[model samples]
Target: MHLIAIDWGTSSLRGALLDGKGHVLEERSHSRGILTVPAGGFPGLFEELFGDWMRLTGSFCLISGMAGSKQGWVEAPYCPCPSGRVEVANAIVEIEPGRIAIVPGLSDVHDGVPDVMRGEEVQIFGAMSLVGLSDGLFVLPGTHSKWVTVKRGRVTGFRTFMTGEFYALLSQHSILAHTLDAQAPLDEVAFLEGVTQADNGQGLLHNAFGVRTLGLFERMPAGELASYLSGLLIGEELRTQSIHGGDLVLIGSPALTQRYQLALEVSGNTARTLGAEATWAGLHALSAIHIANKARS
Candidate 1:
């Protein structure tokens, strides 16, 4: 049997054609993500992107991320915390009779903070498998960064930070807009300087002003403001998260994860990175569990 996995998010749709063993046989993606699809057009767009793969016999489609949200093709409900692969598999919703299933997101109410993740759970589990870790902190850096805790092979809890989105909003639309160059090359020294500032007890709002002042004073080049802001926001996000200070696995784009690794290192933590293969591995894992469940029934 083969598994066709789709990571359908707000901005893009990623699909993978994987063999029984979870190796990717073929893959494709498109910019027409869930947000771009017209009302009630998910099925049509899905067929357009992955119809060939679905046409094959014995192929099962597994989707994750916002495609399972209230706005998706069909709402796949969320699974609670302390969940493992089996829980996620059991929660899968069959959207297309016996052919297609959507993996459920995970929710946690640890420490009075209500946190939820859609596509990131798949990435976290895949990253855990890639690193061969039964327990640790997993960081997925993006618009909504997720800091997840895995214990005894189950997802214990996690938190979300809007660092990336904040950076975008502040840089592009806020008062510091003129100080940033969207295409500027990263200035490592300036970035580290911002991180150092973040640790000085100045809150983000107070520290953010430094971007404009420094540029105004010709102290830091306007071209390098992006790097400094990146460090400041990322540094603050790391500072607030309650990581126990051990090995942290970062799963995301190479560039973004590398930025996070640098911030973690500055905070006296060790980190490693895994890329898209982990998402594929995760979707494959859940799909395998679902297949087993089907056989049992």
Candidate 2:
């Protein structure tokens, strides 16, 4: 059977039509994420987006990400952690029974606090399928970066970092905002310097103030200072992880993953990168399992 994979995020939406063999026949993307849709508009909007593809014989669909959230079309409650394709597939919430469904997000508890993710789980599984490894450290960088660990294809646990969000706040609203140019590209030298400063034993709060001082002392240009601040924050995020493997998996956009790969290399590590297509691969994989199971039941 063919597959229609939709990754509906908070700010954007992506869909793909994959042939039975998993080759993409067509794809579509839009900025009309769940947040843009008005109350009770998901059903109609979805039909408008892919009503044609759904009409195609043997085509099935799986929706992932925030599209299944409480605020989304219909809440597909999160599946608990230690989940694999089997567990996730089994929990698939049917939006149109046998035709369309929403893949549930994964949830885990850390130190008595609950942590959750939506679309990132599929990417992790897709990375697993693509790289042919079920166990490794998978990092998905974004506004809320995720550090996930998998053992034999099941996600055991993970952590979330507000690194990107912190960057935006510090670069735009903090006391150091005036001292740096937030729009600057990555300045490798200054960026690494900030990365190094993150490990100086002074801690991030203490080290962050140095950005303004450097500006005051004319130690760095505005653009370079921005890169430095970025490196510092990303470096601080990296400091918490125990990265030692050669087969580290970094999944996300090139711009974000590039920064992570650079940071990892500086710490004597390497990683393989995967793009957004991993989302489709993951959804396709899950769709197969889900369809097969449904047939038996």
Candidate 3:
């Protein structure tokens, strides 16, 4: 069976055509994300890309991410956190005439703090399939990073951090951007040094400006300084969150996976790396789950 899986994110939309075995047959991406797609443009874009497949195979479609947000095609309410794949899949919104289903995101209120996530829930589900049913933590690193805990196939609880967005703003938009250059390869040694500093309990807010100062006063190279700043932010996240001592699954691009792996090591933890293709795995998993649910009904 062929399936259409859409991984719609805030900044981009990625779709894959996959066989019954979950091997990708073809894939496509568009920069026209949730922000770019006008109020009613979903149908047009969906048709433009997959109209041919719809005519030929009439495959079922399952989607995750901002596609279910208020701005997207439909508003699938969030399934509060601490829920499992079965719970999330059960909450899917059906768009009929065609069998397109949107997976609801997750949200919860803990300690008077309300948090939400969209894309990472699918990722967690996909990761669970690969790692098997276990009690552990899954760490997804991106614009909005998530630290998710799973036990017995249910996502028990999770936390979100603003590491990626903070890095972007500090490196490009903040005053620190003026003092640094973006032209050099990452400096592994300097990065580890920042991790060490963070592990030693140096507060992140206090250390953030030190990046610019290091470059200006001590002649720290721009490239190494950039990597150092990145390490500092990520290290602070690890330190504050205490991500060590658990089974850690790091998800992101290879470069990011490596960085997080290094951070985990510095913090006296071990982590297994999941490839960036986990997004595809997630989309396909949602598609298969939805299709099976339909068959049962």
Clashing pairs in 2: none
The sequence of per-residue lDDT tens digits that candidate 3 reaches over residues 1-297 is: 677788887788888887778888888888878888887888888888777666556587787889899988888999986788778877889876346778899997779998888988888777777776467889999888888888887888888999989989998998879867655677889888777777555588778888888988966877788888888988988876755476778877787888898888875788877864676677677766666777798
Count of steric clashes across candidates, in order: 0, 0, 0
lDDT of 2 at 23: 87
Clashing pairs in 3: none
Q: What is the alpha-carbon lDDT of model 1 when measured against the actual structure?
A: 0.88
Against the unseen true structure, what C-alpha lDDT does each candidate score?
A: 0.88, 0.91, 0.80
Better of 1 and 2 by lDDT: 2
lDDT by residue for model 2 over 72-141, one digit each (tens)? 9878998898999899989999988988899999999988999999999999988899999888999999
True-vs-predicted CA distance for residue 211, candidate 3, Å: 0.8
Question: Which stretches of model 2 miss by more than 4 angstroms?
Answer: none
Best by lDDT: 2
Q: Rank the candidates by lDDT, best first.
A: 2, 1, 3
TM-score of each: 0.97, 0.96, 0.94
User: Candidate 1: worst 10 consecutive residues by lDDT?
Assistant: 238-247
